[model samples]
Target: MNTLVTGRRLARELGEWRSTGPAYRALADRIRVLLMDGRLASGTRIPAERELSGALGLSRTTVAAAYSKLRDDGYLASVRGSGSTLVLPGLERGDHAPGSGLPLDFTKAVTLAYPGVAAAYAAAIEQLPAYLAHDGFDMVGMPDLREAIAQSYRNRGLPTSAEQIMVTTGAQHALNLVTRSLYSPGERVLVEQPTYPHALDTFASVGARMLSFPVSQDGGWDLSEAQLQLRRAAPSMAFLMPDFHNPTGTSMTIPEREFLTAAATREGTVLIADETTALLDIDRGALPPLACFSPGVITLGSLGKIAWGGLRIGWIRASRDVLARILRNRPAQDLGTPLLEQLAATSLVRELPVLAASRSRDLKLRRDMLVQLLGEQLPEWDVAVPDGGLSLWINTGTMSTSALALAARSEGLGLVPGPRFGLDGAFERFLRLPFGHDVEQLRDAVKVLGRISSRVGPDPLRMPLQAVI
Candidate 1:
């Protein structure tokens, strides 16, 4: 019998292991993990049906079903005798996955640890069996976890209640659910230019019209332009990261927050305040959340940045009315976030002091290293040292980041171009470099990037920044 070695061979080389099981589920899960981990390069040819099924000890019919699902998910390509192959692009495991042996992965923004987490998780798991007798489908979330989240917000000066909280798969799912519930097709939404790149894609999928305002590295958002867009567009919803905004790391000023929220209130614009990165406040004495200023804001908070991305639990704090509407909309997307993860997050949340301490040390160390490295090696590049967060937004001014990324990729390095975060490719002159990796890994990536940057053409910011005001 043909080992069907070629398909299993190539796939296994990329870490797609085959499994023998009563159900094809084990094999299916293996395929999903490979894709999610990015081992399955998008557009790669897959193995033949007969080959894979036989090699993996699964029924041909089972293999066919698995392949069909993968195909539906854009993870595999189908052909005749050539068979299917792993082919999926970027995917999230909900929380941060610790770095494996990949050469370089500066694309993700995650730190090493928020310490004391293991202990908390262990305790939570130990406590989990006590409740395992009941079904763990916590769509609304656990009361204890909800209380912890609400308490955290209250500690930060935002009035929160367990009644207002709803746990989710992640901030991504939370955003999707909020958009679906509150906004309509053809309704307008506003985001920062060069915002969280993936969010634009997610929001766009729901047919939300997008308007972006420029926010500078010095951290000034175009208030006038934003107000104009809100008034003219009368957007039904808006997503703001008032704290440690993505890409540029711009935080909204108290004045800006007050003015914007007042206008949004007048126009009845529902604000999606993504506080996901806000907890990463290295400033120690950072201002209160924008949600504190506006009752209309539906704040989204997650454990991914502060604790671990793998925790896969985020919550939204909204009015009772909005909560009811969101609850109604929940069934279409997901049945509920897994009860186990909720338990994990709850355990983590209660242990914030220990987690926050470790995260602070970890992020501060990485940030310092990146700043020193960038200053010493890539001085020509305009890089901002953000107050908090796992990444750096470096201005390669007027350079083609796409070309730079391609060159780096060829050198066994991975990077996402700035335009990936911009609509109509606005930030082609910039790039977001995550220092959220092992120090050794980050240093290596910077070295490779230094080489790539050197080979590239002259930078447009060659002219001195006339005023760093």
Candidate 2:
């Protein structure tokens, strides 16, 4: 179904609207920024010029001029009687708005394949002959791979058994399976304010109503508020990324984990912890996995970050009952995990610690380099140096990151803007910059960002909204 932004809603999203340029240009630019940031999703219907003008207390002429600017810029289309519809430039061509087959892609936080990945594949092929006698199709996962995954959890101070694991093609595949199996239509799902974008996509696809709490780079999780929401909303489930928590890169403290676990158990809310980036550690020492705090917590683990994303193997660690429920629903989406991928994942799991150490050393170097480049080039922007995780969550003070992202596209750069991580048009001034690229690529990205930052200028509504002078 297509989204239609009402006049009142768009007016609220537009905020203060005024900028250094002409009013019409500013209005059009803001709309373009919103579209770029994913706050105003593609294919959404824009209000008629006269209706928007009336809503914002502007003349129809000004609104018409704004619409004309957007149309000329390839951001809007109008029909005689059907009204205007929003269009993202590259998306109309069936490509991503940014990084659609682009050479320099920063939209993904993953890095190049690990050095040992090739060896694992070779070993998997050698081990393949033993399973040739049986039918290749398997749904629950191969026995060896499940045992390896379970042992990994045991190493992490959490007890596990092979019966508690179910392998999937990737972490995303696992998340989708879990969401579909557990959530009912219109049920409330709790999430962080600026969580992973694709996770938000999965939740929305299920028609789940979302409630959020803030997770700041400095302050970490707002546990008090999270507890309040748990008590008040009584959501069906709470999706969390507790370890190096996605864009923010802040892991939950041990006490915070225990506190949250207790709260969830009391409220009867199921907590799903995404540990995809859990092993991507730099200087942050080990923290207890959220599942260790409570048996009810369902954990998602993946080798995508620690090894190679192309390996495409992940698992869900849940109680036997939940695992059984997930297995029953699994075939509706996929027949089974690939035999070749499972063999490779088993081989990789045995060497997990060695691979993780190698990845950590490489990530630390890249993180330091990226931080230095951003500090020297774009000093005005507030950047948090995350101890773990692959990205930096930047606070672009007084500047609209959505505008910066739009401008970067002209330079052949791809960026996922801040609002992509939040709901209801929040995080417009924030951006996630991944440090998983090569040093040279990071340098080039910083240069492009520095150039674009100056052109993007300050956000008009940086301060509280008040009566215009």
Candidate 3:
């Protein structure tokens, strides 16, 4: 079924859309920005021109011109009776399209493979022969791998057993499995305002009605608002990243975690915590896992950031009952986690602390270097240096980050706009710049951005938001 965005809703999402352009162009640009930001899903039926014009208190001619501009830009397709439908160029909805052959892609916050990954793979191949005697379709995961994952939790001060674990291909796959198993269509789901973009895609893919509270750079998680929403909306599930949060790079305090856990318990909301970036700590030290405060919390962990992106190993630490529920629905999504990957993961888990130390050292150097470069090159921008996490969340101050992104694209730099990280087109001025690249690459990207910033106006060229890898 095609999703429809009513005129009133679209107007609400427009959120002070005016920019330095003609009314029609500004309107069209805002719509295009919204589409690229994932605020407007591809294949969604847009409101009719007249309906939108009335809703925004604009003339029909202006709305018609805006629609015409959007159609010309390949963002909308018009049908006679049915209204215009949003479309991304050269691809359909749910398709995984690569970046625009750009030399530097800042859309992903991942680094290259860890140095120990190759040896781990070799170890996995050696261990694989022993497992070949039995059928390789592993739905629940191997006992050894599960135990390793459980031990990781135990080391973190959270007591987890093997039965409470379910391994998947990656953190993304784990999130998908958990969301599909736990959430029903049309159910309310709460999330951080600026979260992992792909996580937003996950919730949206499930037809979830999302509610959000702000995750500010200075204020951190808005506990008061979250509590109010939990009590008022009573959402079924709340997805969160309490440690080294994506985009924001801020973690919640222990008191905040306990408060949220208590509130969610009272509201019957299950907290699904993504700890994919939990161990990416640089100097902030460890905070207790969100699950430590509540048994109902479901935590997702991954080796993508710490070990290697290509390794493709992640697991869910939930109750035994929740693991069973996920297992029952697993086959429809995938046959099982790969045997070789699990074996490699097992080896990597044991080497985590060493890998983490190495990773932290490298990350600290790159992060500090990137921060210095950005600060020197772009002094006007408000760049926050996070203690840990993959990226620096920047407030572009006077410069529209979306515009900066568009301008940077001409210089062969790919970036995810701020709105892509949040719901309903928020965070337009913010940008997530990952320092997971070589210092040279980081320097070049920042120099390009600084150069482009001066040339591009506030109304940057609107482009599609790439599916985060």
Candidate 4:
């Protein structure tokens, strides 16, 4: 079914879209950015030109021209008696394949596969035949794999049992399952303002109303605003990344974690902690998992980032009751996590410490290289060097990264603009540059940024106060 974007909704998404260019072209460019960044999905029907014009208080001619430009660029399709629908040109709708036809794709914040992955898979293959006679649909997880996942939690100081684990295809799948089981339609879901973009996608898929608190690069999580939202909104669920938060690599201090968990518990809200990036630690020492504070907090873990993105294995660590609920709802989405991957994951989980150490050494070198390159080449841009996580969250000062991304794409580089991590088109001046790629690629990406910095004009967009914590 095709989704319809209302005029009011489009206006909210097009926050501060105007720039120092023709209004129509600027509007079209902003829409393209939204589409490319996966905020505004492909194949959705947009509001009519007249409706959008009234929503933005612009002339109908301007809206018409914007729509015309989108059609010209093959980003939209129009049919008589039907509205204009967004299209992605050559790619299928909702396709998230790795390659973007760009030479340098910094859109993903993933790292190279852990070196031992092939050996683990080989070990799994030798062990796979032992279970060929049984039904292949393993709903919960293989017993050994679940135990391995539980042991990982125990190593982190959060006592866990195999019964508390339910493996999924990946962390994203685990999140989807949790959201479906926990979130009620129309109930509010609280989130970090600039969170994992796909987490927002999952929440939006359920049509859940969202509230957000800030996680700034300098000041850390805004607990005051978080408490206010929990107390005021009483949202049904709150999504968080306490350890090595995406975009901004700031982890929550122990006090902040304690307070937030206590606050959510008081408000009767379900706290879901995404720990996909937790194990990607480069230098920052271990912090207690959020689950350590509250048994009710649901924790999601995956090997995708720590091992390889190709290894589709992740598990949810929750109370037995929560696991039971998730298990009951699991089959509707997928029958089971692949048995072969689980066998491989069991071995990988056992060797997590070794993998983490290896990733740390490599990540530190690349992170330092990218930081030095950016500092030397684009000194005007403010960059916060994160101790861990795959990317650097940069403040482009006055340059509009949406424009920067559009310009960079033409130069054979693909970048994700700051607004992709934010809601209501916030963070236009910020950019996320992943340091997980090769040193030469990082150097080249920075060079591209430096070269185009002058051409991408300044944007006056500010974070909307209502969306901020």
Which stretches in model 2 have alpha-carbon errors above 4 Å?
11-18, 54-57, 72-84, 89-94, 129-133, 464-469
Per-residue C-alpha lDDT of model 1 across residues 197-244, encoded as one tens digit per residue: 657867776878898777777757778888988888898887788887
- Where model 1 places Cα greater than 4 Å from the true spot, the runs are 1-102, 459-469
Per-residue lDDT of 322-344 in model 2, one digit per residue for the tens? 98889889889999888988898
Q: Write the per-residue lDDT of candidate 4 for residues 1-469, one digit (tens) a residue.
A: 6899999999988777888789999999989888888878888999999999999999999999999999999999999998899988767553443237778899999898898999999999999999999989998999999999999889989899999999999999999999998888879999997999999999999999889999997889999999999999999999999988998998999999999999999999999999999998888999999999999999999999999999999889999998889989988899998989999999999999999999999999999999999999988888898989999998877777888888898888889988888888788778888999988889888898888877875664543433342
lDDT score at residue 218, model 3, on the 0-100 scale: 87
Indicate the worst ten consecutive residues by lDDT in candidate 1.
Answer: 13-22
Give the local distance difference test score of model 1: 0.73
Best by lDDT: 4
TM for candidate 1 is: 0.77
Q: Scored by Cα lDDT, where does model 4 land?
A: 0.89
Query: Between the candidate structures 2 and 4, which one is better when assessed by lDDT?
Result: 4
Residue 466 lDDT in candidate 3: 20
Which order, best to worst by TM-score? 4, 2, 3, 1
Worst 10 residues of 3 by lDDT: 460-469
lDDT of each: 0.73, 0.86, 0.85, 0.89
Each prediction's TM-score against the native? 0.77, 0.91, 0.91, 0.96
